[model samples]
Target: MKEFLGTLGQTTARAYGEDLIDFSRWFEESDGIELVAGLVTTLDLRDYLSHMLTVRGLKPSTINRRLAAIRAWLQWAKRKGAINDLPVFPRHLSEPKRAPKSLDRVEEARFLRSVAREGNVRDNAAIGLMLYAGLRVSEAVSTKPSDIEIGERKGKVIVRNGKGMKRREVPINADGRGMIGPWLAKANSDYLFPGSVGGHLSPRTIQELIKKYAYQAQLDPNSVTPHVLRHTFATKILRSGVDIVTVAALLGHSRIDTTAIYTQPSWRDLERAVDGREGGNGE
Candidate 1:
Protein backbone atom coordinates (compact mmCIF):
# COMPACT_ATOMS: atom_id res chain seq x y z
CA MET A 1 0.00 0.00 0.00
CA LYS A 2 2.82 2.38 0.92
CA GLU A 3 4.65 1.58 -2.31
CA PHE A 4 1.47 2.17 -4.36
CA LEU A 5 0.77 5.46 -2.55
CA GLY A 6 4.39 6.60 -3.01
CA THR A 7 3.79 6.69 -6.77
CA LEU A 8 1.07 9.37 -6.31
CA GLY A 9 1.55 13.06 -5.40
CA GLN A 10 1.45 13.91 -1.70
CA THR A 11 -2.10 15.33 -1.62
CA THR A 12 -3.54 12.61 -3.86
CA ALA A 13 -1.69 9.90 -1.90
CA ARG A 14 -3.13 11.22 1.36
CA ALA A 15 -6.71 11.19 0.05
CA TYR A 16 -6.35 7.79 -1.62
CA GLY A 17 -4.77 6.42 1.58
CA GLU A 18 -7.75 7.58 3.62
CA ASP A 19 -10.13 5.96 1.15
CA LEU A 20 -8.21 2.68 1.38
CA ILE A 21 -8.27 2.82 5.17
CA ASP A 22 -12.04 3.25 5.12
CA PHE A 23 -12.39 0.33 2.70
CA SER A 24 -10.14 -1.88 4.83
CA ARG A 25 -12.03 -1.08 8.02
CA TRP A 26 -15.34 -1.84 6.37
CA PHE A 27 -14.00 -5.09 4.96
CA GLU A 28 -12.93 -6.30 8.42
CA GLU A 29 -15.92 -5.05 10.39
CA SER A 30 -18.77 -5.72 7.95
CA ASP A 31 -17.67 -8.62 5.80
CA GLY A 32 -15.06 -10.41 7.96
CA ILE A 33 -12.67 -10.24 5.03
CA GLU A 34 -8.90 -9.67 5.30
CA LEU A 35 -8.93 -7.39 2.19
CA VAL A 36 -6.18 -9.22 0.32
CA ALA A 37 -6.13 -8.02 -3.30
CA GLY A 38 -5.97 -11.61 -4.58
CA LEU A 39 -8.74 -13.02 -2.32
CA VAL A 40 -11.22 -10.10 -2.75
CA THR A 41 -14.01 -11.17 -5.09
CA THR A 42 -16.48 -9.27 -7.31
CA LEU A 43 -19.21 -10.01 -4.73
CA ASP A 44 -17.17 -8.19 -2.06
CA LEU A 45 -17.01 -5.09 -4.25
CA ARG A 46 -20.75 -5.27 -4.97
CA ASP A 47 -21.50 -5.56 -1.25
CA TYR A 48 -19.25 -2.58 -0.53
CA LEU A 49 -21.05 -0.51 -3.14
CA SER A 50 -24.41 -1.44 -1.63
CA HIS A 51 -23.17 -0.58 1.86
CA MET A 52 -21.89 2.83 0.75
CA LEU A 53 -25.10 3.67 -1.08
CA THR A 54 -27.74 2.24 1.29
CA VAL A 55 -26.13 2.14 4.72
CA ARG A 56 -23.84 5.13 4.57
CA GLY A 57 -26.08 7.12 2.23
CA LEU A 58 -22.99 8.40 0.47
CA LYS A 59 -23.32 10.49 -2.68
CA PRO A 60 -22.61 8.73 -5.95
CA SER A 61 -19.62 10.97 -6.61
CA THR A 62 -18.12 10.18 -3.19
CA ILE A 63 -18.70 6.47 -3.64
CA ASN A 64 -17.17 6.62 -7.10
CA ARG A 65 -14.09 8.40 -5.72
CA ARG A 66 -13.58 5.78 -3.01
CA LEU A 67 -14.09 2.99 -5.51
CA ALA A 68 -11.57 4.63 -7.84
CA ALA A 69 -8.96 4.66 -5.08
CA ILE A 70 -9.56 0.97 -4.36
CA ARG A 71 -9.37 0.14 -8.06
CA ALA A 72 -6.03 1.92 -8.49
CA TRP A 73 -4.52 0.14 -5.48
CA LEU A 74 -5.73 -3.24 -6.67
CA GLN A 75 -4.30 -2.63 -10.14
CA TRP A 76 -0.95 -1.76 -8.59
CA ALA A 77 -1.05 -4.90 -6.43
CA LYS A 78 -1.74 -7.00 -9.55
CA ARG A 79 1.21 -5.46 -11.43
CA LYS A 80 3.45 -6.34 -8.46
CA GLY A 81 2.28 -10.04 -8.73
CA ALA A 82 0.19 -9.88 -5.55
CA ILE A 83 -2.78 -11.04 -7.63
CA ASN A 84 -2.76 -13.16 -10.81
CA ASP A 85 -6.30 -12.24 -11.97
CA LEU A 86 -8.04 -8.98 -11.04
CA PRO A 87 -11.55 -9.06 -9.60
CA VAL A 88 -14.18 -7.42 -11.76
CA PHE A 89 -15.17 -4.18 -10.14
CA PRO A 90 -18.80 -3.07 -10.10
CA ARG A 91 -19.89 -0.19 -12.34
CA HIS A 92 -19.86 3.26 -10.78
CA LEU A 93 -23.10 4.74 -9.51
CA SER A 94 -24.87 7.18 -11.82
CA GLU A 95 -24.62 10.84 -10.83
CA PRO A 96 -27.39 13.21 -11.83
CA LYS A 97 -26.55 15.92 -14.33
CA ARG A 98 -27.00 19.44 -13.01
CA ALA A 99 -26.11 22.83 -14.40
CA PRO A 100 -23.22 24.62 -12.74
CA LYS A 101 -24.52 26.96 -10.02
CA SER A 102 -24.30 30.71 -10.55
CA LEU A 103 -25.77 33.77 -8.88
CA ASP A 104 -28.69 35.48 -10.56
CA ARG A 105 -28.76 39.23 -11.24
CA VAL A 106 -30.40 40.08 -7.91
CA GLU A 107 -28.12 37.82 -5.87
CA GLU A 108 -25.04 39.16 -7.66
CA ALA A 109 -26.10 42.75 -6.93
CA ARG A 110 -26.63 42.00 -3.23
CA PHE A 111 -23.32 40.11 -2.98
CA LEU A 112 -21.39 42.91 -4.71
CA ARG A 113 -23.10 45.47 -2.49
CA SER A 114 -22.04 43.52 0.58
CA VAL A 115 -18.47 43.35 -0.71
CA ALA A 116 -18.53 47.09 -1.41
CA ARG A 117 -19.82 47.75 2.11
CA GLU A 118 -17.29 45.58 3.96
CA GLY A 119 -14.45 44.44 1.65
CA ASN A 120 -11.18 46.25 0.95
CA VAL A 121 -9.77 46.97 -2.52
CA ARG A 122 -7.83 43.72 -2.52
CA ASP A 123 -10.90 41.62 -1.75
CA ASN A 124 -12.97 43.42 -4.35
CA ALA A 125 -10.34 43.02 -7.04
CA ALA A 126 -9.71 39.35 -6.26
CA ILE A 127 -13.43 38.61 -6.39
CA GLY A 128 -13.74 40.67 -9.55
CA LEU A 129 -11.24 38.50 -11.42
CA MET A 130 -13.42 35.45 -10.79
CA LEU A 131 -16.80 37.17 -11.12
CA TYR A 132 -16.03 39.36 -14.14
CA ALA A 133 -12.99 37.92 -15.89
CA GLY A 134 -13.93 34.22 -15.30
CA LEU A 135 -10.57 33.26 -13.79
CA ARG A 136 -10.30 30.07 -11.79
CA VAL A 137 -9.35 30.62 -8.14
CA SER A 138 -5.83 29.28 -8.76
CA GLU A 139 -5.37 31.47 -11.82
CA ALA A 140 -6.63 34.51 -9.90
CA VAL A 141 -4.26 33.92 -6.96
CA SER A 142 -1.22 33.25 -9.17
CA THR A 143 -1.84 36.51 -11.07
CA LYS A 144 0.74 39.27 -10.69
CA PRO A 145 0.23 43.01 -11.09
CA SER A 146 2.42 42.88 -14.21
CA ASP A 147 0.08 40.24 -15.75
CA ILE A 148 -2.68 42.85 -16.05
CA GLU A 149 -2.79 45.57 -18.69
CA ILE A 150 -5.43 48.32 -18.31
CA GLY A 151 -5.65 50.97 -21.01
CA GLU A 152 -7.99 53.92 -21.32
CA ARG A 153 -10.69 51.93 -23.10
CA LYS A 154 -9.46 48.32 -23.03
CA GLY A 155 -7.67 45.85 -20.73
CA LYS A 156 -6.73 42.16 -20.35
CA VAL A 157 -5.51 39.81 -17.65
CA ILE A 158 -2.80 37.35 -18.68
CA VAL A 159 -3.12 33.96 -17.00
CA ARG A 160 0.40 32.55 -17.36
CA ASN A 161 -0.25 29.28 -15.48
CA GLY A 162 -3.86 28.34 -15.87
CA LYS A 163 -5.32 24.82 -15.54
CA GLY A 164 -2.95 22.27 -17.15
CA MET A 165 -0.39 25.15 -17.18
CA LYS A 166 -1.99 26.51 -20.36
CA ARG A 167 -1.85 30.29 -20.80
CA ARG A 168 -4.73 32.47 -21.93
CA GLU A 169 -5.62 36.17 -22.07
CA VAL A 170 -8.99 37.26 -20.69
CA PRO A 171 -10.28 40.69 -21.64
CA ILE A 172 -11.43 42.84 -18.76
CA ASN A 173 -14.64 44.80 -19.08
CA ALA A 174 -15.51 48.03 -17.26
CA ASP A 175 -16.67 46.19 -14.11
CA GLY A 176 -13.38 44.28 -13.84
CA ARG A 177 -11.30 47.42 -14.50
CA GLY A 178 -13.27 49.38 -11.90
CA MET A 179 -12.47 46.87 -9.18
CA ILE A 180 -8.85 46.20 -10.23
CA GLY A 181 -7.65 49.77 -10.82
CA PRO A 182 -7.63 50.79 -7.17
CA TRP A 183 -5.69 47.70 -6.06
CA LEU A 184 -3.16 47.95 -8.92
CA ALA A 185 -2.50 51.60 -8.00
CA LYS A 186 -1.73 50.62 -4.40
CA ALA A 187 -0.17 47.22 -5.18
CA ASN A 188 3.27 46.60 -3.58
CA SER A 189 3.65 42.84 -3.18
CA ASP A 190 4.98 40.61 -5.99
CA TYR A 191 1.62 38.82 -6.04
CA LEU A 192 -1.57 40.79 -6.54
CA PHE A 193 -3.13 39.19 -3.47
CA PRO A 194 -0.26 38.31 -1.18
CA GLY A 195 -0.52 35.79 1.64
CA SER A 196 0.59 36.22 5.25
CA VAL A 197 3.61 33.97 4.52
CA GLY A 198 4.64 36.17 1.54
CA GLY A 199 3.24 33.99 -1.27
CA HIS A 200 -0.13 34.48 -2.99
CA LEU A 201 -3.27 33.70 -1.00
CA SER A 202 -4.27 30.04 -0.96
CA PRO A 203 -7.42 28.93 -2.80
CA ARG A 204 -9.05 27.98 0.52
CA THR A 205 -8.53 31.52 1.81
CA ILE A 206 -10.13 32.95 -1.31
CA GLN A 207 -13.06 30.48 -0.90
CA GLU A 208 -13.52 31.55 2.72
CA LEU A 209 -13.48 35.22 1.72
CA ILE A 210 -16.24 34.59 -0.82
CA LYS A 211 -18.25 32.68 1.79
CA LYS A 212 -17.90 35.54 4.29
CA TYR A 213 -19.41 38.08 1.89
CA ALA A 214 -21.92 35.48 0.72
CA TYR A 215 -23.27 35.21 4.26
CA GLN A 216 -23.30 39.00 4.55
CA ALA A 217 -25.30 39.22 1.33
CA GLN A 218 -27.88 36.84 2.93
CA LEU A 219 -27.19 34.28 0.19
CA ASP A 220 -26.46 30.62 0.89
CA PRO A 221 -22.72 30.51 1.55
CA ASN A 222 -22.63 26.90 0.36
CA SER A 223 -23.90 27.96 -3.06
CA VAL A 224 -21.68 31.00 -3.57
CA THR A 225 -18.09 29.92 -4.19
CA PRO A 226 -15.31 31.22 -6.40
CA HIS A 227 -16.26 28.65 -9.05
CA VAL A 228 -19.87 29.81 -8.86
CA LEU A 229 -18.67 33.37 -9.41
CA ARG A 230 -16.75 32.17 -12.48
CA HIS A 231 -19.90 30.36 -13.64
CA THR A 232 -21.88 33.55 -13.13
CA PHE A 233 -19.46 35.41 -15.35
CA ALA A 234 -19.71 32.75 -18.05
CA THR A 235 -23.51 32.63 -17.84
CA LYS A 236 -23.76 36.41 -18.10
CA ILE A 237 -21.43 36.56 -21.07
CA LEU A 238 -23.12 33.68 -22.90
CA ARG A 239 -26.61 35.10 -22.27
CA SER A 240 -25.48 38.36 -23.89
CA GLY A 241 -25.29 36.36 -27.18
CA VAL A 242 -21.53 35.88 -27.23
CA ASP A 243 -20.43 32.82 -29.18
CA ILE A 244 -19.58 29.60 -27.31
CA VAL A 245 -16.04 29.55 -28.75
CA THR A 246 -15.41 33.01 -27.34
CA VAL A 247 -16.85 32.10 -23.92
CA ALA A 248 -14.69 28.95 -23.86
CA ALA A 249 -11.58 31.05 -24.49
CA LEU A 250 -12.54 33.55 -21.81
CA LEU A 251 -13.00 30.75 -19.26
CA GLY A 252 -9.82 28.92 -20.46
CA HIS A 253 -11.78 25.79 -21.36
CA SER A 254 -9.96 23.59 -23.87
CA ARG A 255 -13.26 22.02 -24.95
CA ILE A 256 -16.32 23.93 -26.14
CA ASP A 257 -18.55 21.29 -24.46
CA THR A 258 -17.22 22.39 -21.09
CA THR A 259 -18.28 25.97 -21.82
CA ALA A 260 -21.68 24.66 -23.05
CA ILE A 261 -22.69 23.96 -19.44
CA TYR A 262 -23.41 27.69 -19.11
CA THR A 263 -26.09 27.27 -21.76
CA GLN A 264 -27.96 24.69 -19.62
CA PRO A 265 -31.07 26.22 -18.02
CA SER A 266 -30.90 26.73 -14.29
CA TRP A 267 -33.80 25.80 -11.96
CA ARG A 268 -34.74 29.48 -11.74
CA ASP A 269 -34.71 29.77 -15.52
CA LEU A 270 -36.96 26.72 -15.90
CA GLU A 271 -39.33 28.05 -13.25
CA ARG A 272 -39.53 31.40 -15.00
CA ALA A 273 -40.25 29.72 -18.32
CA VAL A 274 -43.07 27.69 -16.81
CA ASP A 275 -44.49 30.73 -15.00
CA GLY A 276 -44.44 32.79 -18.21
CA ARG A 277 -46.27 30.08 -20.16
CA GLU A 278 -48.96 29.78 -17.44
CA GLY A 279 -49.44 33.56 -17.40
CA GLY A 280 -49.79 33.62 -21.19
CA ASN A 281 -52.43 30.89 -21.06
CA GLY A 282 -54.41 32.79 -18.39
CA GLU A 283 -54.25 36.01 -20.44
Candidate 2:
Protein backbone atom coordinates (compact mmCIF):
# COMPACT_ATOMS: atom_id res chain seq x y z
CA MET A 1 0.00 0.00 0.00
CA LYS A 2 1.15 3.60 -0.55
CA GLU A 3 0.74 4.13 3.20
CA PHE A 4 3.40 1.49 3.85
CA LEU A 5 5.52 2.93 1.02
CA GLY A 6 5.30 6.44 2.46
CA THR A 7 7.30 5.36 5.51
CA LEU A 8 10.34 5.11 3.25
CA GLY A 9 10.60 8.89 3.39
CA GLN A 10 11.31 8.91 7.15
CA THR A 11 14.91 8.71 8.38
CA THR A 12 14.14 5.68 10.58
CA ALA A 13 12.21 3.69 7.96
CA ARG A 14 15.10 1.33 7.19
CA ALA A 15 15.48 0.42 10.85
CA TYR A 16 11.73 0.24 11.41
CA GLY A 17 10.98 -1.95 8.39
CA GLU A 18 11.78 -5.22 10.13
CA ASP A 19 9.45 -4.43 13.02
CA LEU A 20 6.66 -3.45 10.63
CA ILE A 21 7.11 -6.64 8.61
CA ASP A 22 7.16 -8.70 11.77
CA PHE A 23 3.88 -7.11 12.83
CA SER A 24 2.32 -8.13 9.53
CA ARG A 25 3.71 -11.64 9.85
CA TRP A 26 2.40 -11.96 13.38
CA PHE A 27 -1.03 -10.75 12.27
CA GLU A 28 -1.21 -13.56 9.70
CA GLU A 29 -0.20 -16.14 12.32
CA SER A 30 -2.85 -15.12 14.85
CA ASP A 31 -6.15 -17.06 15.01
CA GLY A 32 -9.33 -15.40 13.66
CA ILE A 33 -6.91 -12.88 12.13
CA GLU A 34 -8.91 -11.70 9.13
CA LEU A 35 -6.07 -9.21 8.46
CA VAL A 36 -8.28 -6.60 6.86
CA ALA A 37 -11.71 -6.62 8.48
CA GLY A 38 -11.51 -8.63 11.72
CA LEU A 39 -8.53 -6.59 12.93
CA VAL A 40 -10.42 -3.32 12.75
CA THR A 41 -11.78 -3.75 16.27
CA THR A 42 -10.51 -1.87 19.34
CA LEU A 43 -9.78 -5.20 21.04
CA ASP A 44 -7.54 -6.21 18.18
CA LEU A 45 -5.91 -2.81 18.02
CA ARG A 46 -5.18 -2.75 21.78
CA ASP A 47 -3.71 -6.24 21.63
CA TYR A 48 -1.32 -5.16 18.89
CA LEU A 49 -0.41 -2.08 20.91
CA SER A 50 0.40 -4.34 23.85
CA HIS A 51 2.61 -6.50 21.67
CA MET A 52 4.55 -3.49 20.41
CA LEU A 53 4.89 -1.89 23.85
CA THR A 54 5.60 -5.04 25.87
CA VAL A 55 7.42 -7.31 23.43
CA ARG A 56 9.04 -4.76 21.14
CA GLY A 57 9.51 -2.00 23.75
CA LEU A 58 8.72 0.64 21.20
CA LYS A 59 8.36 4.31 22.13
CA PRO A 60 4.94 5.99 21.97
CA SER A 61 5.97 8.05 18.96
CA THR A 62 7.14 4.93 17.14
CA ILE A 63 4.04 3.00 18.13
CA ASN A 64 1.82 5.89 17.14
CA ARG A 65 3.49 6.26 13.75
CA ARG A 66 3.03 2.54 13.01
CA LEU A 67 -0.55 2.79 14.19
CA ALA A 68 -1.14 5.81 11.95
CA ALA A 69 0.29 3.90 9.01
CA ILE A 70 -1.93 0.96 9.76
CA ARG A 71 -4.92 3.26 9.97
CA ALA A 72 -4.15 4.80 6.61
CA TRP A 73 -3.82 1.39 5.00
CA LEU A 74 -7.11 0.30 6.55
CA GLN A 75 -8.81 3.52 5.41
CA TRP A 76 -7.66 2.82 1.89
CA ALA A 77 -8.83 -0.76 2.16
CA LYS A 78 -12.23 0.31 3.55
CA ARG A 79 -12.77 2.74 0.72
CA LYS A 80 -12.19 -0.11 -1.69
CA GLY A 81 -14.59 -2.47 0.28
CA ALA A 82 -11.66 -4.62 1.41
CA ILE A 83 -12.47 -3.69 5.02
CA ASN A 84 -15.41 -2.30 7.04
CA ASP A 85 -13.95 0.42 9.31
CA LEU A 86 -10.84 2.06 10.74
CA PRO A 87 -9.22 0.63 13.84
CA VAL A 88 -9.91 2.90 16.76
CA PHE A 89 -6.73 4.80 17.53
CA PRO A 90 -5.53 4.57 21.12
CA ARG A 91 -5.94 7.99 22.69
CA HIS A 92 -3.14 7.39 25.16
CA LEU A 93 -0.64 6.44 22.46
CA SER A 94 0.77 9.90 21.83
CA GLU A 95 4.20 11.28 21.13
CA PRO A 96 6.06 13.41 23.66
CA LYS A 97 5.39 17.02 22.71
CA ARG A 98 8.27 19.41 22.16
CA ALA A 99 8.91 22.83 20.73
CA PRO A 100 10.36 23.26 17.23
CA LYS A 101 14.09 24.15 17.05
CA SER A 102 16.22 26.96 15.60
CA LEU A 103 19.41 28.97 16.24
CA ASP A 104 19.84 32.57 17.42
CA ARG A 105 21.52 35.02 15.05
CA VAL A 106 24.76 35.29 17.04
CA GLU A 107 25.18 31.50 17.12
CA GLU A 108 24.19 31.30 13.47
CA ALA A 109 26.75 33.99 12.59
CA ARG A 110 29.46 32.05 14.44
CA PHE A 111 28.47 28.86 12.61
CA LEU A 112 28.65 30.70 9.26
CA ARG A 113 32.08 32.09 10.10
CA SER A 114 33.28 28.58 10.91
CA VAL A 115 32.08 27.33 7.51
CA ALA A 116 33.80 30.21 5.73
CA ARG A 117 36.88 29.57 7.88
CA GLU A 118 37.14 26.09 6.36
CA GLY A 119 38.43 27.88 3.22
CA ASN A 120 36.75 25.14 1.18
CA VAL A 121 34.66 27.14 -1.24
CA ARG A 122 32.28 24.18 -1.38
CA ASP A 123 31.86 24.21 2.37
CA ASN A 124 31.25 27.95 2.26
CA ALA A 125 28.56 27.48 -0.39
CA ALA A 126 26.98 24.49 1.35
CA ILE A 127 26.54 26.36 4.60
CA GLY A 128 25.66 29.55 2.75
CA LEU A 129 22.98 27.75 0.75
CA MET A 130 21.43 26.40 3.95
CA LEU A 131 21.60 29.68 5.85
CA TYR A 132 20.84 32.18 3.09
CA ALA A 133 18.59 30.14 0.82
CA GLY A 134 16.83 28.32 3.70
CA LEU A 135 17.24 24.96 2.00
CA ARG A 136 16.59 21.60 3.61
CA VAL A 137 19.77 19.52 4.10
CA SER A 138 18.64 17.00 1.50
CA GLU A 139 17.84 19.81 -0.96
CA ALA A 140 21.26 21.35 -0.39
CA VAL A 141 22.84 17.95 -0.95
CA SER A 142 20.88 17.17 -4.13
CA THR A 143 21.40 20.50 -5.93
CA LYS A 144 22.67 20.46 -9.54
CA PRO A 145 23.85 23.42 -11.59
CA SER A 146 21.38 22.43 -14.27
CA ASP A 147 18.61 22.62 -11.68
CA ILE A 148 19.58 26.26 -11.22
CA GLU A 149 19.44 29.22 -13.57
CA ILE A 150 21.94 31.91 -12.56
CA GLY A 151 21.37 35.30 -14.06
CA GLU A 152 22.18 38.92 -13.14
CA ARG A 153 18.76 39.97 -11.71
CA LYS A 154 16.49 37.05 -10.85
CA GLY A 155 18.14 33.63 -10.44
CA LYS A 156 16.36 30.43 -9.38
CA VAL A 157 17.14 27.09 -7.70
CA ILE A 158 14.95 24.32 -9.13
CA VAL A 159 14.34 21.61 -6.57
CA ARG A 160 13.60 18.59 -8.74
CA ASN A 161 12.75 16.00 -6.07
CA GLY A 162 11.79 17.97 -3.00
CA LYS A 163 10.29 16.74 0.30
CA GLY A 164 7.48 14.86 -1.43
CA MET A 165 9.58 14.38 -4.56
CA LYS A 166 7.84 17.39 -6.08
CA ARG A 167 9.63 19.97 -8.22
CA ARG A 168 9.45 23.75 -7.88
CA GLU A 169 11.50 26.78 -8.85
CA VAL A 170 12.87 29.08 -6.11
CA PRO A 171 13.84 32.57 -7.20
CA ILE A 172 16.98 34.24 -5.81
CA ASN A 173 18.72 37.58 -5.99
CA ALA A 174 22.23 38.92 -6.69
CA ASP A 175 23.32 38.22 -3.10
CA GLY A 176 22.46 34.54 -3.47
CA ARG A 177 24.34 34.35 -6.76
CA GLY A 178 27.38 36.02 -5.23
CA MET A 179 27.35 33.55 -2.35
CA ILE A 180 27.21 30.54 -4.71
CA GLY A 181 29.64 31.81 -7.40
CA PRO A 182 32.91 30.72 -5.81
CA TRP A 183 31.80 27.12 -5.26
CA LEU A 184 30.11 26.83 -8.67
CA ALA A 185 33.28 27.76 -10.63
CA LYS A 186 35.69 25.37 -8.89
CA ALA A 187 33.32 22.41 -9.07
CA ASN A 188 33.11 20.70 -12.47
CA SER A 189 29.74 19.06 -12.61
CA ASP A 190 26.05 19.54 -13.20
CA TYR A 191 25.80 19.30 -9.38
CA LEU A 192 26.01 22.69 -7.74
CA PHE A 193 27.11 21.18 -4.41
CA PRO A 194 29.14 18.07 -5.07
CA GLY A 195 29.76 15.37 -2.48
CA SER A 196 33.04 14.14 -0.96
CA VAL A 197 33.98 11.70 -3.73
CA GLY A 198 31.64 13.20 -6.36
CA GLY A 199 27.96 14.23 -5.90
CA HIS A 200 26.08 16.24 -3.30
CA LEU A 201 27.29 16.00 0.33
CA SER A 202 25.80 13.24 2.46
CA PRO A 203 23.23 14.12 5.15
CA ARG A 204 25.53 12.55 7.76
CA THR A 205 28.44 14.78 6.75
CA ILE A 206 26.27 17.91 6.81
CA GLN A 207 25.11 16.86 10.30
CA GLU A 208 28.71 16.27 11.36
CA LEU A 209 29.65 19.77 10.25
CA ILE A 210 26.80 21.18 12.32
CA LYS A 211 28.04 19.22 15.35
CA LYS A 212 31.52 20.61 14.75
CA TYR A 213 30.15 24.15 14.85
CA ALA A 214 28.05 23.52 17.97
CA TYR A 215 31.17 22.29 19.82
CA GLN A 216 33.23 25.24 18.63
CA ALA A 217 30.51 27.69 19.60
CA GLN A 218 30.09 26.17 23.09
CA LEU A 219 26.39 25.63 22.37
CA ASP A 220 24.30 22.57 23.08
CA PRO A 221 24.59 20.06 20.25
CA ASN A 222 20.79 19.72 20.33
CA SER A 223 20.46 23.43 19.57
CA VAL A 224 22.08 23.20 16.15
CA THR A 225 21.54 21.22 12.97
CA PRO A 226 21.45 21.60 9.19
CA HIS A 227 17.63 21.71 9.43
CA VAL A 228 17.80 24.21 12.26
CA LEU A 229 20.05 26.39 10.16
CA ARG A 230 17.41 26.21 7.45
CA HIS A 231 14.76 27.06 10.04
CA THR A 232 16.93 29.91 11.28
CA PHE A 233 17.08 31.21 7.74
CA ALA A 234 13.30 31.15 7.40
CA THR A 235 12.82 32.55 10.89
CA LYS A 236 15.12 35.48 10.17
CA ILE A 237 13.46 36.07 6.82
CA LEU A 238 9.95 35.90 8.33
CA ARG A 239 10.94 38.18 11.22
CA SER A 240 12.24 40.68 8.67
CA GLY A 241 8.67 40.67 7.20
CA VAL A 242 9.25 38.79 3.97
CA ASP A 243 5.78 37.24 3.49
CA ILE A 244 5.03 33.65 4.52
CA VAL A 245 4.27 32.58 0.94
CA THR A 246 7.68 33.91 -0.12
CA VAL A 247 9.40 31.92 2.64
CA ALA A 248 7.31 28.88 1.71
CA ALA A 249 8.41 29.15 -1.92
CA LEU A 250 12.03 29.76 -0.88
CA LEU A 251 11.86 26.73 1.47
CA GLY A 252 10.45 24.62 -1.41
CA HIS A 253 7.38 23.55 0.55
CA SER A 254 4.67 22.04 -1.63
CA ARG A 255 2.06 23.83 0.44
CA ILE A 256 2.02 27.20 2.17
CA ASP A 257 0.47 25.37 5.18
CA THR A 258 3.67 23.38 5.63
CA THR A 259 5.75 26.55 5.56
CA ALA A 260 3.55 28.38 8.12
CA ILE A 261 5.03 26.35 10.97
CA TYR A 262 8.36 28.16 10.42
CA THR A 263 6.63 31.45 11.16
CA GLN A 264 5.86 30.50 14.79
CA PRO A 265 7.25 33.39 16.77
CA SER A 266 10.38 33.26 18.86
CA TRP A 267 9.68 34.21 22.48
CA ARG A 268 10.96 37.74 21.80
CA ASP A 269 8.76 38.15 18.75
CA LEU A 270 5.69 36.72 20.50
CA GLU A 271 6.13 39.04 23.51
CA ARG A 272 6.36 42.11 21.29
CA ALA A 273 3.25 41.13 19.32
CA VAL A 274 1.32 40.49 22.55
CA ASP A 275 2.44 43.78 24.16
CA GLY A 276 1.66 45.89 21.11
CA ARG A 277 -1.98 44.72 20.94
CA GLU A 278 -4.47 47.65 21.19
CA GLY A 279 -7.30 45.78 22.94
CA GLY A 280 -8.86 47.64 25.91
CA ASN A 281 -6.92 47.33 29.20
CA GLY A 282 -8.63 45.71 32.20
CA GLU A 283 -10.08 48.09 34.86
lDDT of each: 0.91, 0.71
> So what's the TM-score on candidate 1?
0.68
lDDT value for candidate 1? 0.91
| Model 2, span 30-114: residue lDDT tens | 6446354435577767878898899889899888777766665666568877766676777767554332477777777676676
Q: Give the TM-score of each candidate.
A: 0.68, 0.58
- Score candidate 2 by lDDT: 0.71
Q: Which stretches of candidate 1 lie over 4 Å from their true place?
A: 1-96, 280-283
Please write out the lDDT profile of model 1 over residues 169-264, one tens digit for every residue: 999999999988889888889999999988999999999999999999999999899999999999998999999999998888999888887888
Q: State which candidate has the highest TM-score.
A: 1
| Model 2: ten consecutive residues of lowest lDDT | 274-283
